[model samples]
Target: MLFDLPDDAVLYTALLARDAAWEGRAYVGVTSTGVFCRMTCPARKPKRENCRFHETVAGCLEAGFRPCRRCHPLACGSGAEPSVAPLVAALEADPARRWSEDDVVARGFDPSTVRRAFKRQFGITFLEMARLRRLRESAGVLAKGGKVIEAQLDAGYDSPAAFRAAFAKLLGQAPAKFAEDALLRADWIDTPLGAMVAVSDRSALHLLEFSDRPALPSSLRHLLKASKGSLGLGRYAPTDQVEAELGAFFAGQNATFRTPLALEGSEFTRTVWQALVAIPAGETRAYADIAREIGRPSAVRAVARANGANRIALVVPCHRVIGSDGALTGYGGGLWRKRNLIELERGYARA
Candidate 1:
C-alpha cells in the first residue's frame, strides 16, 4: 500500500501518462492479455476496466499475470541487464562451468564491471552466482534420488569429499546422507531472490527457509529431531506443490498455496503464526497491530518474538509486518530480501 492506489481512476491516469514515478512503485495487471507491466511500460495501454493496479510485481503475478515482454519489468535491475546479459546467458547455458574472475576478463568483459553489475542486479558476484548455479544443478539431481557420486560429478566438483563438504555447508547434511525413501524429504527451490530449502512429509510441508540463512541448519535439525530423525533428501507432493505455487507467486500471479503445513511451536506461537497467515498479501501490519489482532494488546514484544520464531517464510507472511514507525524490521532472511518481498508484494518491483 505504499503507493496507495485505491482508485482505478488515479491508477489509470498514471498508466496513461506513463508515469516513471509509478514505474517500480505501481503495476498494471491487464486482464485481457493476462500480463502485468510497470506503469512506464511503453506497450499500448489497456482499457481501465481491463487494468487492475497492484503494488508489487509479485502481487500481479499472484493475480495470474505474467511479466510483459515489451517492458521487461524483471530485467530492470537484474544481472540480465544489457551489459551483463551475454555473460549471464553463457553461464546459464553451461551452469557447471568453473567460472573465475580471470575467465571473465578473458571473455572481454572487465572483471570489476562484471562484478559490480552482478552485485547490483543479483546481490551476488558473478563467480558466486556460477557456484550457486552449479550447486542448484547438482541439488536437483540429488532431489530426484541420484547417487552422491553422480551429484558430485554433475555439480562439477572434482571429488566426492569436496562435494560433500560443500553440500553439507549449504544444506547441513552431506549428499550421501540423503536417502531416497526417508520419511521426510528436503528439496531445493530456485527463486528470483535466491534459493530456498523446503522440507516436507508426504502430506504437509514442515519447513521453508532461504538456503543461506544461518538458522536453516538448526531449524532443519530441530525438525528431524521432532520427527524422530525420520528425514532425508528428496521431493514430496507438498514440496512440489509449494514450488509450483512459489513459481506463480514470483511470476506476478495470485497463487493461493493450498499446500498443507506442519510446524512445531508453542500454542501461543501457533496462534501468532496463524495471525500472520491471516494478513493479506500486498498489505502490512505493525507488530502492535498484530498484538491487538491476537487479543494480546500488551504483548507487542512477545508478538515480535513469535514473528521472529516463524520458520515458514512467505507462506506465513511474517514479512508483512513492519516496525511501528513504518521502518523495515529484522528478518532472519536478510533485510534486503524482506524489503524485496515487501516491494514485490506491493507491486513496486526491481529487476
Candidate 2:
C-alpha cells in the first residue's frame, strides 16, 4: 500500500521538531534556497511558507530542488552508512578507475565489509556500483561513435575480451555488435532513483527498465532476438522523447507519457498492460481487481504475471498495483523503488 504522509501542518510540525521518524519517508524542499533536506537536517529551519514537503527524493528533484550538501539527502537508505560513505566519496572522485578488491584492501577496508555495507543500504555492492558507472560512461562513448577499443581503455579495462564480457553481461550484446544503422537503439536515462536503459525504434519506445534490474540482460537479449540483431547502442527519436517525458515525470511537472510505445506481448498480456495503464498515477489496484477489470475474474494469477512482465516501468504504471491486503507486491524494479514511486505519485494525485 502507498504510505500516506501527514498533512502539511503536521509535516511542518515534524520538520520543526527535527523528527527522525520521518528521516527516509519525508523530505523538505526550501523554496528560498532551492534545496531539499531530510527532516532531521541540522540546518536552520525555513519559514513555514517557504517549505515544500515531498515524499521522495524524486519529488524534491522534480520540483527543481537540489539536495542539501550538509544533510546529504541523496545518500542511500535512511542515511549514508559510515562504512560506505568514504567509499562512495572515492568513487565519485575517480569514477573511471577500475576498482578491485585489492584496492579496497590497500585502502585498509575489508572488501567483504564494504560489500555488505553497500548491499544493505543500496541493494548493490560498491564494486557493482562502480562497474555500472564505468559501463555507462563507455556506452556514452559508443553512442557518440567512438571506437570499441577507445571505450574499453576509457572504462579502465585492459583486456578487450574482459570489456566485451562485462558489456555483454549488462547489455546482452557485445560492444562490437552494436551497428551504426540498427533499427532499434538503446540509451541510458538517469533518474533520481537510478539509471534506466531505454530501447526504441525511430517512432516508438520498446523497453524502459532500470539498468540494475536482475532481468535486464535477459530482456535485452529477447529484444535483440526480436529485432533480428538490429539493436544498437544509441538513442532514437522516441528515446529522446521518452527521456524528456521521464524528466518531466520525475520532476512532477507532468504525469502523462506522450511517447509512443510498442507493447510486445500476447493478447491477454497486452490487455492486462492496457488495464495497468488505465490506473491513475496516485491510485492502486489488486491483481484480482485488474483481472475483473479485464473480464477475467479467474485470471488473477495471470494478471500478476502480466504485471511482472511489464518492462516499461513508470510509464506503464505497474508499480501502482498492490496486494489484495494493500501490501506492496512484487515489482521488477524492487519493492523499495515501488514504494518510492507510489509515494512520489501521491503528489500527482494532490496536484
Tens digits of lDDT, candidate 2, 1-351: 223666668989999999898988888888667678999999999998677677766555444455677887757373456667777667656767899999888888999988887777655677876676577668768988999998998788879998999999889979999878998998877665666889999899999998778999999999999988998888889988887787677666788998899999999999999999999888999999999999999999999998999988888999999999999988888898888898888889998
**Model 2 CA lDDT for position 68:** 79
Cα RMSD to the true fold for all candidates? 8.3, 6.9
Clashes found in each candidate (C-alpha, N, C closer than 3 A)? 16, 1
> What is the TM-score (0 to 1) of candidate 1?
0.68
lDDT of each structure?
A: 0.76, 0.82
Q: Write the per-residue lDDT of candidate 1 for residues 130-172, one digit (tens) a residue.
A: 6765776687677677888888887888778888888888777
Give all TM-scores, in the order shown.
0.68, 0.75
Evaluate residue 265 in candidate 2 and report its C-alpha lDDT on the 0 to 100 scale.
98
Taking all chains together, the TM-score of candidate 2 against the true structure is 0.75
Off by more than 4 A, model 2:
1-94, 116-125
lDDT of 1: 0.76
The Cα RMSD of model 1 versus the native structure comes to 8.3
